[model samples]
Target: MSMSALRRGRKAVVALTTALAVTLVSCSAGEEGAGMGEQQGTPPSTDFFGYQTNSRLVTTNAGTAFGAATNAELLASRLYPAAFVPGPGGQLIPNSDLVTTQEITEPSPDAPRKILYTISDQARFSDGEDVTCEDFLLAYKAGKMRELFGSQKPLANEISNLQCAAGFKQFVVTFNPGQGERWRYLFGPGTVMPSHAIAQKAGLTQEELVGALYAEDPYQLQEVARLWRYGFSVTEFDPDLQLSYGPFVIDRVGPDGEVILKANEDYFGDAPALEQLVVWPRSADTQRLVEDGALQVLDSSTANPTWYDRDSETNPFTLQSQPGDLTDTLVLSGYGLFSQQWARQAFAACVDQGRLAQVSSEKSGTEVAPAYVHVLRHSDPLIPRLDPVTNPHKKTDMELAGQLAGQTIRIGYLGPDERLAAMVQAIKESCEAAGVTVEDVAAEHMSQIHLEIDPETGLPTIDAFLGPVDPMYEYGGPEALIQNVSALRVAEEKLWEDLYDIPVSAQPRTFILDRSVENVVPYTGLSGIGWNMDRWNINEELAGQVTATSEETSEQ
Candidate 1:
């Protein structure tokens, strides 16, 4: 059948399902009446539904450049499992179910840099199609050509070639000379998609899609790009277009911003513990949701610590927190007043970072220390060896900031975060002493503050952003930061000189889970609790409820 025909059929099924749901509701209402009393039999089982807070009701998980961390975890990660996933204790481990061998060759005078990835034969999409080299090729093409593909990662540009056949299970990517070591980073997360699905959406065969990517056919690639960029939207979700190869596939996106995921029976790896998972959008009424038993788990990053009462017996959730990989920092913009190094340095010098850290700690209910270097983490071994003198911005220099007196510095933070607000207030107070006015422009999302350019001046709306930064992706260079302690220190020193980012305090990660959720481990990495969500199960016996059982699903 044609893709269009399949989509039409799915739409018809959805319409019929909606009509049937209404009929079921009407029938359910009459169950208390004598005539419908016989219709009632065994009570329906309460399926496992996991909840996570998303800021927006409608979001697209497509395009790695602009994908959100929440969508990456709750939706994309499980829907399209990456080759390497975040392991316990901040480690990146290969997915043994998909990847068999990964080899990297450094660039030499004799040979070009090459990275080879061999996938296991077991790797297959939810639709029973083999996860092939064509998918990786499309990923590479989309990531490399930013204008056409909407990818913003710098790692894509380092790749020179992606050598593969259409249905080959392996692909060798040759990188440009002097490029950094990026094996752990490539095809890791939010990069790979089912090429056949995209091809089907674009009204072409998988072979034709491969040819377009290799030939760089603009018109044909645009059709592919159109779907690749905007097809996986939650609001107008298409099950046929947004098929998952992982353990779970999206069942439906609810009207109230709840995303329902059902286990994929076609998955070849370990079966998911639960048959159904639901991700609820984050809202101010989170506590109410917990109390009402609607929310089972919350894998949150920016949620305020004070919102929940940990001791309350009425609430079914317990809040767990740890220091996360993302550090809350003042990210300077490279336009307007901040264009000058002195202006940037002066602003950084005036802001009391220690006080900012203290505020973050106090607000977050976590013991956060001031970070001096931008790149290195607080737990790094190299931090002790680095001279304190290397970081000169430890003390606030009012004299330096006085030079920019009467100038207004606008700062923004994504969403309404309490810690970020406190840090911004601290900055405002400290900078106010030097006659510099600090403006707080709280943004609904990251793009509003970072990417939205003012037409008149062509500068970002906010001069700096008070938020979290993943240093690895934010400050990647030709050499990997993890090469050695010395290299790490050098990178930190270079970042210090630039003043592009002023380290405030490490972000406190938080998770709220009901007692029914079992086998969950707190991870400090990017994916949070949802990293191994497939392993998580609801202990229904303990919670006095029966869980709905389903057939075995796909692997992630």
Candidate 2:
């Protein structure tokens, strides 16, 4: 999905408005025909669904957890429906499944970019409490203070006062100067804590309550920061404490490391498609469960040909892929002998990106695009141009790299994983051709390498540093590359003017799924295959056909 399509509140309103007049029709025939039905077309049972991952959701910290735990939170975000939800095409579409309507009116282009939003009268929390303007204000205030669930501290810096009118149906929020572009990030996804309840429980004065929720005072700021770090561990949900407003409530955590969520029939929107959602820690053995018919959906990361092509007659298996927002890059540190522009450029020019991508695909089971920009946004300049076939800028001279000999270049790398290691080895060989001896260093020990250059001589203590580069694709746009390069430039003030470590390609998260799964939606930054949890469903008839074939073979 494109980043522009993921803005939760505004983009959703825009997409639904445009889609209102159109109807989507499915062309599939046979048992895969559209509309939910059994045998003759009945909606699948809304009792249980199966999903598998390769890690555990141990931390509730949204900013820190980047693996399985983060995926779990995303899954929960769908079940515990937020006020706004991302749509199928990656547009933030209303969870008409939860919220009825959320309308926003902004001033004309001639006026300031401020906006006013009005909530639907039918909106209510899962607890049956009317979702008033105050609720939004409270949510915004908590989010801005970074006291709400899943809040990012950097996002809290953009919002201003969020005030609800006395009638409770109208509310207004203003943004800080220069934050107009960042409004979406500020109010994206997070839990809405009950403001009245929290204030009453804390027994604070109105002034103090405002301060705590808005963090106007240093004490309140510190307290909210503490809660932001450690709030989930507080047992028991009090009205003042954070409580989920989604379709499911956290029932009990399992000793076997499973999280059980039961449907909240009182949910304000349409009841969830499932009665229960049991999330288990991700495991490598998850494929066994699918083979045994216990799991209906498994991420492509874990699906091998053996399981993917499991006999439908007996195993009833299907396959599919979920696209994600992961990017892998080859980063060069500015500290080493590589601090020289000629040295870095020479190295970047010699490495063959096409071969590197081929090796990466073989090892990572993902299609490695040669460009540095993500495949989805082909126009974004973040992706570097590196194909020897298409790139006219590729270095054609090997003798040029020979001048940097005797200067040892250190390259940092993630691991001995397939794509990265292969790329590193290829670069090492290429450097050898140029007469430069390259040393591979662990990425963890990057800080210890002090290869500052001598300003007078314009030569580094060490030659160069190369490794895996982790860039923030979610927050920064095309300028992300420039900013990354600029930071290196600023730190190593005397280094060459040219950017070190030209980005070769983005290592994106790829999901492979059974083709039978319909309307599968994948989110960005999602690694592994289970990113689309609720959307996965099976075509039982196709499964049965596969099963039958397997049974006949077993009898023989």
Candidate 3:
């Protein structure tokens, strides 16, 4: 069927569904006291909560060409269901609702490694189309065209081919020999989107889109590329475009960066526990919003000290604070003076990572241990196997940094983050003794690294990036993934030798929950608390009790 015809039929179905819902609600109201609990549904499905985010929503579409994919991934994961999701403690768990079967075939001398995925038959798009292998194919094609899009996940380069018949639920993605060591994460959160939506937006059929993707002519895929790059990225809510197969769908978006989400009634999997979800901008008054019963969840990796200063009596909330999966590092740009390994090493020599970690821990009100490795986090099983002295930059040496005595190193970060700002201050203090000047340039996003290049210096305006780096992407090697601990050790050794990335500390973060909220599990993975937000709900009984107590106190 044509995309427009399908959409028209879908709209008719929606209208019918809405009329039936009204009838059902009317019938239920006659039998039960519907008005008694009408306003009790979490935020009434109409209310918007101001969720304070550390990073601004540059794009809701994660793992796209955008460099802020890490910042947007957590939010984007909520909208699109993936094959696998990061479970507790960073373990890769299959998202059963999306994929029914997933297995990796061992690589042979002749045959390469193959990842076979059997998508759930029940899986569908919010527009009432079946989730087919075409979607995955689109993702594979987009991943390979990184140069066209400007940025992409490292997994894109490992794929040799994607095999599947059109409309088939099962697809096999074959990797080049010795590639895809990290195959489990291929379609994990925010990496894939609905192919039908992209095709429809680009004014092409699924068959035509596939042909364009494989064609030698880049001009054929121009519209497709444009849609893939900037289609879903919206500051304002557009239900027609931002359809969801997941538990919740975007309802409204405010001018001040507030995103309101309502439960997806047509979700094939488990329904969302809460009816409405509000995502506020980073600059919102978080604590005040929490006290006013407007915000129930405050999950942040860079929350301030005031968030932790809460008494149980006055502030009834659960706080889960710990080290996160991301590493806060002072990454050097591969340009200008830092392009040379020795120059990168010299800059790293003056930066005391231990002292930086101390400042980060102190400012963030959490214990952030000094990190030395880029490929693995401190909690990884392979961490102990690696050589202890793999990174020699941990011990700051002023003499080595003196090589760049009069040169100024410009460092940038996704700003307004107090922790990163403190770390930058600490870096400036430590580097001054070596006569090296450190300039702090705060950027709205990471794309500034390539966009604002200085012509004379052959360097980005922001020479180095100071923020969190997902180690999965930072491993230094011809291959993106390492085979084992031994290979990882070698990769880490090479990483230290390159000296471009300086791992400062494992990121420390805290998730605070209001007393009236329930079923919030704190995972240290990139997704954080919102990983299972579809399951999160308002504790209606607790909320009722709190309301009653407040009324009683007022009467007294």
Candidate 4:
């Protein structure tokens, strides 16, 4: 089912359970001033509110909600540093938090390329654990299993006999044969999990610690995998398991789906502007919450359609819309009818892109653009553009579509809702205009579509798949995009080439705060306030603004 529909269904189930007078309470953040002691009017040190999913943490499979959500919260923080960090200008900068300096000491005279990363003395974990060469060895070993083998196993297939060892306060990683050049791309941006703590808990020998990760025994490895999955839980996440070298830490998760976060006092760098952060899940009625003085910051995703109506004098909060990097695209399978570039181009030309955008704007209040490319201002400059207007098959003319009639094409899409339905209907209409017989197949679970390609044909049996692209990690530059595209082209079978995947708009994965919150830095694509719970605080001025606005709206 569509995630939105599933959420709606779950909401109904929760409501039914609630109607039975069942108190559904999970993790509760205790009374504010009780356990932590009294604050002397300088404002409570920890404060923020938000929401969380059912699961706290899970395996980092990239596909699972647990992996995607938790990793976004945990790893992106300064505490768990990656080799490269996203700078202010949305580029991957050097790892300033952990490494003082990095220099490529030796250039390879042979086909293999090599670079050296020198460590600094200043780096330390939150628990005063020195960031050492051993830690890097442990991290690489763990990552090889968890990231490369466990979830993104395809990555490991490209390389042969990857080796690493601790050397004089530095860890040297070398890839075998022709794989050396790809080491930087493979090893960078991975979170270095605490090796000493994890290894000690696992109770394995040093040799076993390094070699057991790549064990051929499936049964033995499954047991070891469980350890990595629940490693944080074993420590009770004490001292805040969501500890960070970053600016924040998870504070509390509430039963009512509210999450609260406070600032990390030990943050290494310049502190953030906002102090407290809160994020409420989709459970609460956002418009009602905004009007009831419960929420301050809102996004285009969560904002109700009614909230954008300028004619509504009863609305208290001002709504601002900005273009984002998210895009909704109609992707075609390279096999079947879509195999021909002209066939795909013909469909694109017939569909009224402007009309589809208008319907989307009406339904969701999100702006839409009429380009095949997903990210805004990021057209493939390498490719020359063709005029859609001048094309013979272009236009919403139904007579033109009749020429391609009787061709059976199945298209898959998410949601049966009005917006998506309108898009589907438009596509069907356009196809019929081109004399094509299109079948609208219901793809309730969009993720499953990724796995549904035929093994023998290597083509997506379904003609098309439509959905939004949430570009979680920013591709730093055109070169990065080129590299990624090239990798996918090399990896993907010939039948999946030239498939459509576009990012249309950008959305800030921000922590929603009550008006009282202050001094929080919003991370893009990371949801939930507790993702960075340590840096949250309550601000009376912001609280008063929410209260006053709610009161005025309620009276109206």
TM-score of each: 0.79, 0.58, 0.83, 0.58
> How does each model score on lDDT?
0.66, 0.44, 0.67, 0.43
Clashes of each: 5, 39, 1, 52
The parts of candidate 4 lying over 4 Å away from their true place are 1-82, 100-115, 118-163, 166-169, 172-207, 214-220, 224-244, 265-267, 270-276, 302-318, 327-359, 371-556
lDDT of 2: 0.44
TM-score result, candidate 1: 0.79
Question: lDDT value for candidate 3?
Answer: 0.67
Candidate 2: deviation at residue 193, Å? 6.0
Higher-ranked by TM-score: 1 or 4: 1
Q: Measured by TM-score, how close is model 2 to the native structure?
A: 0.58
Best by lDDT: 3
Q: Which stretches of candidate 2 lie over 4 Å from their true place?
A: 1-48, 60-73, 80-84, 96-111, 119-161, 164-170, 176-186, 190-209, 233-242, 302-315, 321-359, 371-473, 476-553
Residue range 476-503, candidate 2, lDDT tens digits: 2222344544433232232212544344
Clashes of 2: 39
Q: After superposition, how far is residue 7 of candidate 4 from its true place, in Å?
A: 28
Residues 137-180, model 4: lDDT tens digits: 54444444542223322223333343444223464455443433
88-115, model 1: which lDDT tens digit per residue? 7666777878775545665686676787
What candidate 1 gets wrong by more than 4 Å, as runs, is 1-47, 54-65, 69-71, 104-112, 147-149, 203-223, 300-309, 312-317, 335-337, 387-390, 452-457, 477-483, 544-556
